[model samples]
Target chain A: PSSGIEKPTVKRFESYKRDSQLPQAIGELRILVDYRAQSIILPIFGRPVPFHISTLKNASKNDEGNFVYLRLNFVSPGQIGGKKDELPFEDPNAQFIRSFTFRSSNNSRMSQVFKDIQDMKKAATKRETERKEFAD
Target chain B: MAAKTVQYDNIYLNLSEKPGKLRIAPSGLGWKSPSLAEPFTLPISEIRRFCWSRFARGYELKIILKSKDPVSLDGFSQEDLDDLINVIKQNFDMGIEQKEFSIKGWNWGEANFLGSELVFDVNSRPAFEIPISAVTNTNLSGKNEVALEFSTTDDKQIPSAQVDELVEMRLYVPGTTAKEDAADGEE
Candidate 1:
């Protein structure tokens, strides 16, 4: 009996090799979508933390009262709705950052950030699908 | 002889919305902003410990006081470490510990509760830390999962435009034993 399941291959991605390579705009302490690096830099406390585009699940933005909130969801284990083939981790047992939400009074900028993340995710997914098709 | 006062301009006090001038002398430390009527000062005797680390703005000097929450002063260039170290040693007789941060962009890490902070360490180096006091709510979102909501209100007086405030964070913890109180009778 053949079980038609294939093992998922681990995907590897690197954001930056050195701290000095981070963009100068990170000094503003704002969420920066770096197209060149294919990563999003988030200001955690006083450090600019980067998340590669491959790790992102999705991003969303919404307005509430006087502020707008931007939420970033990362791919992690135990997710229910996503396809089984979409599990992209090298080790499913590893601890994961499930999500992060940031709020700012700058609504327009938050919207742009959300859009940029979605666009990047779409491009990455399309590229992955094309690669798989070519392999087939 | 007059006291040797080291002054650094364009420093932010406690991640303030605005930058100010910081002066370190034998008497104490003083931070003044153009918007403030009086300068904020802390006597040398009140200082317990201080640390230097790379920050988004450049560098941060965190001063832990004897009887208050620690104060963070950011915006020091990397070149300023030596002069600041000498000033602290000569004036306050205290050494500044250099805290190294992990630059690896990995999302997975061990979240350790340290004092009043939640330190997330990657490969044993701190990736980032969150103040436990700022967390407004926590809930077990799922099995072995926890979600923490932070108060994004400008209660710290940090300008909303200056920094993107973290509102919420979710973590996945593995190997959390399900409440085995019921299974105890069977086993």
Candidate 2:
């Protein structure tokens, strides 16, 4: 009887936009923690946006009333700190990918999401260690 | 020592470039725009990191310098992009070597990029490999950040003196380290 039953669909983390507005840089997204790929996938407007586990530098959460605010450090390779170009031109920072804060429905759900992120980071580190061991 | 030049539009999200030049020199990279008075020259040593990214029109080459802001060269034909990466890779190869200790004290002993692992041989010490993914960033300019941080790896830390030597070898951008040399010299 158990073999005849179909498996339940895997539920990815979905954001609740009741009181808080989403950031313009990152529009509506359905976040999925992909352990195999070692990345977090956010399908934004039909496009699958992926953030590698390594780029996630920091993560923190604050629970207030019925909601939890999750703060994420999105570190990009582009933010370099330097002076303006000699000819009065624009100089963009290299290592300063902005930290994003989003509202989730409850502490339980937000904690689960944070745990998933932590898991991905650990998995990435583990993979690197394995590669190094093999090379050695 | 070949000097190859390619021209493309430097596309920004809300802006356009009217045929910019990318000159590949043996020692470094040169980029110039029509509005700029002088062509920007970035020695290979100054380039902290570089990567490719997809853009709305085509692809963009992002270069992060140690002492400067990140620059994006956009709208490249696929062929041109291939050529650019090849040239840069060649330059990078020249910088890497086995058993090289050009700098004082700290010894590279033998280091090679084997696949994605940066395998290192430090003289009598056991050789170790560091996965490229473990590196969060590089210090090209030797100013704010250390030249290389092994904290990304789970391995035991080398003596602080050795770490300093590695920084001197990998991160020193010719002139900036002079300011900190006195303090570093004390140790």
Candidate 3:
């Protein structure tokens, strides 16, 4: 108590960076369908704000068992099209799927939605560990 | 002709009422204010969307009045519509309540996009319906050829609560413009 040194338990507005490869925070993905074509777009929120659109694959309304996946990294807010990368577009009609009636997505409530996914992953990991131990 | 029954493609809740989380995902309610309704009027030029922009994705807001078995179910009663209207009146301010919405984007301040303003009350109760009629051109897939949402908002978070509390009601306007287009050709 006599020493003028303080404990380093406080955080916020300060930090030190090290070799950290922690997972990234995923944002929302938007999907839209035109008369005969479909387009997918990703809006990333981070350091380098990137907007990517997909080429219209032979897509339609009734087609199921399909997915449009996107990853967002490095998006600096308040800036337009911050340095970023993207997948090529399949839809020919769109310069980039500008905007359209947003189709359905599974991220309505973000917090619990993503949390459930993470939880399932953890459960899978635990099961995998158990199975390995049993084999040993 | 009998009013055909419409099935909704999506039905979800919005918890923007939680403290500090201003705009709910999917249907970002606050993307633009009611006054901007002026600039969104006709002769479409691919302008900015009011609130239903991509920034507000993943959030679902709807107030559905369904009747699977009209005799036994909570039928689409006049009280139901009025109740929904009352919910809208309380959530949004006076500016929102009077912001006239139409099935056409012709006159001034008419909608040119497919979205609605889910005005929820400070008590986390959904209270308004800002129907968007500019959704015709969009070729959205699924049962709800058209989409709509209902929202409940609050200034603070209710501890241990779920997202359902934020979006207290819902309704889907499917092929809403299909009927409007038929009327558009005439007076």
DockQ of each: 0.63, 0.03, 0.02
Compose the digit string of candidate 2's lDDT tens values, residues A13-131. Answer: 22221112222222222345656445554421112234456546567777778656666654432235422321111112222223434555556756887899987777766876775
In model 1, the runs with Cα more than 4 Å from the true position are A1-9, B1-3, B157-163, B177-187
Q: For residues A1-136, what per-residue lDDT tens digits would candidate 3 score against the true structure?
A: 2356534321111111111211122122222111111112221110101111121111112112332112112111112453233222122111121211112223433333334334433454476467546744
DockQ of prediction 2:
0.03
Which digits, one per residue and each the tens of the lDDT, describe model 1 over residues A27-131? 888999998889999887656888888888888888999899888988888876767678476766667899999988888888888888999899999998998
- TM-score per candidate, chains pooled: 0.87, 0.30, 0.17
Candidate 1 lDDT over B11-67, as tens digits, reads 988777689999998899999987677899999887878889888788899886665
Any residue pairs clashing in model 1, and if so which? none
lDDT of 2 at A26: 23
lDDT of 2 by residue, B45-128 (tens): 877666554332344565655554345455554456566666666665432111211111121234445444454433332133
Every candidate's TM-score, chain A alone: 0.91, 0.54, 0.24
Q: Tell me the native contact fraction for each prediction.
A: 0.71, 0.00, 0.01
lDDT of each: 0.80, 0.43, 0.22
lDDT of 3 by residue, B130-182 (tens): 32221123333333232222222234222211222211111122233423332
